[model samples]
Target: MAGAGSWFVEQPPAEPPAEASASFERLYRAFLSARAALGLALVMAQLISVVLGTTPARSTLALSLSYAVAALALWLAPQLRRGASARSLARISSPHWWSAIGVDLILFGVLHALDPSGVNYGALFVMPVLMAAVLSPRMLALATAAMATLGLLGAAAWSLLAGLDVGLKTTQAGLVGSGLFAVSLLAGELSARLAREEKAARGSLALARQQELLNRLVIDEMQEGVLVVDRRGRIRAMNPAARSLLGAASGELSWQLRGRADWQPLVLALERAYGGSAGEGGAEVDVALALDSGAARSLRLRLRFTRQREGSEELCVLFVEDNRELLARTRQEKLAAMGRVSAGIAHEIRNPLAAIAQANALLAEDVAGGRAEQLTRMVASNVQRLKRLVDDVSELAPGMQPDTQPLDVSALVQETCEDWVQVNGVEPGAQSRFRLHIGAPGLTGLFDAEHLRRILVNLLDNAHRHAEPGAGAIQATLDRHGDALDLVVRSAGAPVPHEIERHLFEPFFSTRSRGSGLGLYICRELCERHGARIDYRRATDAAANEFCVRLRTPSSASSA
Candidate 1:
């Protein structure tokens, strides 16, 4: 009975050692083949002498000479092995080349002079085998044919010049030997070609297997899912990670879509935004999927599509990203940083604000009967403003969470703009009148209403304070898209100064004589807390210098 831990014991499989040993085995076989070829030559010499049936003395002399040659070959084997494996196999002239021809000629002369046998032409067979091993197949065949021709010419010259029998047996032997040499040469060439082809095939098979393994290794290691699908949308290939992310086997994805159909909405959103360059679009909404126990968890999916050539067919490779943990961790870090900064500021500024409030109250009572009363009131008002500023700073701490709910963002923008118009008292015929152009209706989203209202008010106030007198009034428009919102507040007046634009959102940074300077900074902070981003930009085509703040609609679950 094994424990559950023992049942799940993990260990690496043994494959690499097996492959290495197989490689060594191939090299050893090649070494043995070269050695066997050399041994064949020695064995052939002994067989030839035995078949000739010469006298004991003559046969012994021939056998001793062959043995001596074999011994010399053995001594050179090490050097031959070293040289043969270097670069190309060492090109060498056959040992019995011209000398073998000379021996054949002498043998013909002896048959003419001594008239031993009418025909004994066994030695000519060795030339073709030796040539095949040493040279290329085509060259070996040509050389062997030439040697056969030369042998025929030598045999004719011997018979005619010596006035010998010139009989049928001698003529037939020359013709038959030449024919055998040519046949043997052709056979050897075919054998060599087949051998080479087999070797190449083996090498190709090994490389293909290795590449497949490498692909599997890479696919298994990736964190994202990668699926290659044909134009018809049938998956053609997938990595192991892709299969796991899709909650299926790689084999299954080849012909079907994996995962839930709920992914389609996000997929369509991504496809629309990214174009064909990215197959899927970034998730604009928090994804909730029913998992075990019907438990719903949030996930952010990014899909991308790319065209690639697979054989002759074009395929779309899909890349899927899971950003749930990444998004959560990012939020956690931001909150932690905000907390530390808030704690430090409270320690440094809260006590000072309290003291200032007490001092102002005392001064107000004492200076009630003089012009000094005016100064005391001013001091008290400034102290109250400072306390408000401190409160705004404290709002930036980590614990400050946005209360998000479904609301009409357009309505919120219009309401805030109207409030700004009323506070600034911009009359219809005033030098700087304020205007609002609300975009088409039904534009809604989920957002922190209070925070959004603040964002609009901040921008409108900035425009009111900076508008040049006698210039065209400010016109603010609240525009909407399918999943995004924007506020363009344009003042038809002087362009914003470059210096002011640079430090517009820095805390405690202000250009006005008596401004708190924390308004824009607070707006930016609130927007970020709600996972919305805002930026200021001058309009390129409009007559008035325009500043814009774009917010991601709640439906757009974009990163903070």
Candidate 2:
């Protein structure tokens, strides 16, 4: 009995272990059901005995009815304890050998002791033994089997004292005890093995879920677009980059690829991959999508397939990249390399340029008013142009921060326009080719004064080159736009061609044979450094070509 007491000793955990608690509750409920059924069977057996005229004792009938009622109460306990804490529920639901097994042992032992019709009640002991084996610890299970063995032997010894066949009864009791012991050990080991497998399965499921979330996060943040599509042209999944590249709305996640005209190229690429035109590794294709904006966007697509195993559908993974962006990135890399080389070349040219300027100045002094004087002047002008070119190229090198300060934009624009007109020899007054209009006085902006001057000079020069020689052929206006200032230089001319407009600010792109092509590029670069923007458009109201520079005001810069 002391060994049997070990079955009831359980330490309540602070927090119930999920897997262990669930497993115990499940097994506990199943055994409770078994106990209830057994109790009913015992009551039915007693009633049948009475109907057959082999009436059992009144005490036996009372014991069977009591067991049935006890079993029913235990089975219904879990439903009454709902919403309880884990520790509380665990205590109520945990399978203890005493709850089911101990009750069954006492009932069977009493029934065996009070045998009325000489029925063998020893077989009933197997129920408690088997229940203990499956639900209790190994030592507890063995202890339970030993207790049942003692009960059987005691019954056999009592029968011998009553002059029954003692030898036969003792041998049967010994054999039954041996079988019970074996069942207990074997069942306990199998139960432990099952628990281990269940725990491993739970860990694997948790790990797989974590990995899935991490993969989704990584894909969403990727710069390149990623799409997962099945063979049926259905877009199963797509990351944010993919949605942006496809111009698809965020909520249009599950749409078919073939539903839209712009998506036909993707459908064809998917078909090619599935139709085996794509290699085992994957395929790459260039596609053009005509968007709602009436513009054709180019994309480079690489399609790869998941390994097609039996019983699983094959999926295609499409990696999409905007071809224009790819080209821009490649161009930037090339430009970076070119900048390094150009910086070196500009440095080497500086010494020679200085020597050439010195020689030109010395030579100009010796010349009189003749072709020699004109030649020296041209040499000096050309040298100045070379120096300007070198300066523009050097500006392209990395790590040049703008030295910005608050300045009067109105005064700068007026001064720059006046100086440009004088330098380019434009006549002032009613018939002046260049007209300057200052809309507001004391309009201050944040800018590098030198950079702003260079930007204005470049824009004025471009306007001068394109403007017809007449009154107001070019107009430079400064005005306020929101919290910023806009300096618009409009020149009377036909609008720039669309083909050339796209590359208007690109480096080394010029229509003239001798044009260095860095004027607008350097202007754009300078504007960007000063946190401003410059763009070109045909002014519809003025019916002229306009280059507008939007300068950041001090207040706007401060707020930003």
Candidate 3:
């Protein structure tokens, strides 16, 4: 088993490739500055030799000027590298590099030749070779190293052949050559490794940016609301849905939500999430907001806490979900289940109810006297009423599948409205009271014809009951745009009561005492079955109430 301390030992953090490259570049410049200073010192030594009469004045002056020129080039190297892009910086010019190496090699050879007695300058050639290793390709660096070695030996050979008293020896030249080749090999390998790491670091940076973009898209498209707040209670980020939920304007991007009166609930919930009051399950809070229209609305929201520690600061993430949506979904599921059970029960009850009607008819036939006739008539009316009730209740049983087909929208709607008018005549003293506005008469829609007729009749019946009687009293508008058709029914009437508006389409909910409360609910179910939506709104210009049905085209209906 490993020791406890070994297991706990922390690994050194890896340096980012970009940062490492920058550091290496700085170090390379420092090396150049050091070489330049050494060259300047060498030039000063030659001047001293001339002043001391140890070397000829003419040769020393030339050598000093040549060495001074090389040193000046080395000092200016760092400035040339500044203000370049990464790719440009990574790439070294082959011509510039060759030129520098040639100048140094030639000058060092001449300086060595000029020195017949003391101080061989051949070793200075290693500076140019090492620089080539740092800035050039591996093969070129090795070649430069070989050239530098040959230049050192050639200077020594020239001294031996020319009968000059040179201080340089063959052994010193060989040792310097071997050292340069080793430095070149090591430097080349290190530079190549640095390049690979820099490339990887750049790739990692790009991937991070892509992930951030994807995360932004998902958050923007989410149905639920989300808000991120920092330790100082500043709202850092919010998606579109959250802004809509709070009734905030699009420009309210930087408002402080910490202690504002309108956003107190949000602030409190955030506090609970961060203050340890909320458990692992978070907190579920119900809030009520009074709208600008003086309408009070209640909302169920779930608050989730996500804590992220950043350095010395704590960042808390608050995820807000509207639980009213959850409740609505749950209600729809219950209704579906109830529909199945009610359908089963209605099927069983239907046969017995029919038998009772038949028995009542048989009794009416047997009794046909003065007092018995009156009683028989009363029994017949009650039996008929009971039958109608049973039929209506059975209709509420769910699973009423629609047989959808492509049908001309305007023609079908006009025909259904005509039937309704014939069955229930319009209010008295009304001329052209019922109008038809068909923007696209031949447009086709995906819907069940029978179900469509029922929906129209139900809406028209309500309109006739609530609308005033006269010309232009009721209008049915049919319009088509691309893949959708709209059917709107409007009439003059006071707006529906706010208290009853929300539950208007719910089963067993009705404003009228005599109504069964399933008319509009059944209409909604029928419309939704055919991938359509029905909504009610009071027109802005007048007190005309409107019911608009949006029916999808046959090809795109399934997506609705």
Candidate 4:
């Protein structure tokens, strides 16, 4: 028995395959059910025979009842209810032969030997033979068949020893044994083939699920929008980017292509794609939508379709991109390239500019207080403007880093405003056009000193250009709020136009032809480097354009 247990034990691979274990559990349960059903059928047949005045021997009745009870017990065993727990009970190598195959063979053999009313029970042996062939190894199945054949022949030999007619009995047992052997071999081969096909199908299904998850992850993280739609205009799937482009709320899931008036253009595009040639690769289309907020949105869409197969539904995939955003991205790339080239050119202009200034100074000395002097003065002024432009451009060079340090916000604002007023030749008294107010004295902030000065000077310059010439026409105020320092420059002028305000900090964008357009842009870059923010708004109290610079104080910076 020990040797038989070792031989029949299933030697699973180092990492047992999940599919193989699952298949074994399924077959095991199926055979248990069949055994229970056969047992009940035998009991019913015995009761019916007794009713017909054909009562069997008392031992035969008891044996049939015992077989039914044992079969029911094994079928409903708690350990066999779950796959993990069923492994030991279901293994063919079990030492005790506790399975239905062993029980069926023993009980059916005894019943055949009883020979009640000479009714043959030999046909019952087929159940155990087929069960072993499908559930156990090929050699084990053959062994089971041999055991049953031996029991049949023994019963026949027993009858022969009793001096009964032995010729017909021995011949019949021999023929049944031959048939059992063939059944065992054929059933075992067929079961093996089915198992192989099932394993392959399960492997394919697992691979397909993994691929689907990967595609979903990639689509969700993409910057461009993606949509999956069927021919009936129902949205099957949509990525985050697509939802954002459509201005759909985050919680909204169900959507139809033709559900809203704004989505009609998309509906038409989808229809065109489906109605056109099946071989068409894809096409790009422009769509304009009127939003509920009285605004219009422009989008570019690329549509493609899955191959229309015979039994599968065709789907359309739309790649959506906001046209305005696309244009802005392209423009930013062009400007970055231009800024690099301009920085190089600005570096080469410094030497020539210095020479021109020296030459102009010399010419002024030779021809003072005349038309020639005026021409020289004009040349000097233009040269200074070009030099300022060059300086601004150099500050914006790609690799430039700020020299950040702590400084008194009030003192810096006061000094920068005084210098700007002197350079621009503004008056110094109460009636002066440019006014400075210091609301906080000891406020310190982290910033580059020279960069801060440049920012202040640019804001003052912009203010002077737009403000009326009167007292408090341009106001520079410094104040502190909690751990922040704010410098607000306000000018009493008409508010900046909405269209131009959006591009104020963009490179090379300006309303004035003579403006270098680098002043505000350079200021914005410097502030960003120092962890500061600059924004423009209309001062409702004064009805003036206000530009506010918010700086991080030392304590706030340290905490961060």
Please report the candidate that would top lDDT against the real structure. Answer: 2
lDDT of 3 at 264: 76
lDDT of 1 by residue, 471-498 (tens): 3567788787556777787766666679
lDDT of each: 0.57, 0.82, 0.70, 0.81
TM-score of each: 0.42, 0.77, 0.67, 0.80
Model 3 gets an lDDT of 0.70
lDDT-best of 1 and 4: 4
Which residue pairs in model 2 clash with each other?
Answer: none
**Tens digits of per-residue lDDT for model 4 on 1-560?**
21121111232221235656666667767877887888888889889999999987887788789988887887898564444322343355563344567777888888877664666777888988987777666667788889989888887887877777768778878888888998888887777666555556666787899999999999999999998889889888899999888876676665677887878888988888788854437788999978656678899999888888899988888999999989989998887788888889999999999999999999899997879989999999999999999999888788677788999888888888878888889988878888888886877989988899999999999898989767899999889877898899999988888999999998878888999888889889999999999999998987699999999988998888
**Which portions of model 1 miss their true places by more than 4 Å?**
1-13, 17-28, 31-35, 38-343, 346-348, 351-372, 395-405, 421-432, 440-442, 470-472, 506-509, 513-517, 540-543, 558-560
Comparing 1 with 2 on TM-score, the higher-scoring candidate is 2
lDDT of 2 by residue, 1-560 (tens): 11211121232222226655676667767877988898899999999998999879987888889889888877878653343322232132343434567778888877775676667777888888777766665566787789888888888888878888778768877998898898887776666556555556767888899999999999999999999998889999999999888888878877788889888888987887789746448999999888766778899999988888899988889999999999999998998898889988998999999999999999999989989999999999999999989988888777777888999989988888888888899888898888888888999999988889988998898898988767998999999999999999999988899999999999899999889899999889888988999999898886699999999998998899
Off by over 4 Å in 2: 1-27, 44-57, 76-196, 221-225, 229-279, 287-299, 309-313, 322-325, 401-422, 425-446, 469-480, 553-560
Instruction: For model 1, give the 10-residue run with minimal summed lDDT.
Output: 2-11
Arrange candidates, best lDDT first: 2, 4, 3, 1
* Clashes per model (N, Cα, C within 3 A): 6, 0, 0, 0
Candidate 4 deviant stretches above 4 angstroms:
1-25, 44-58, 76-86, 90-99, 116-204, 247-256, 278-280, 291-295, 365-367, 398-415, 426-446, 497-500, 553-560
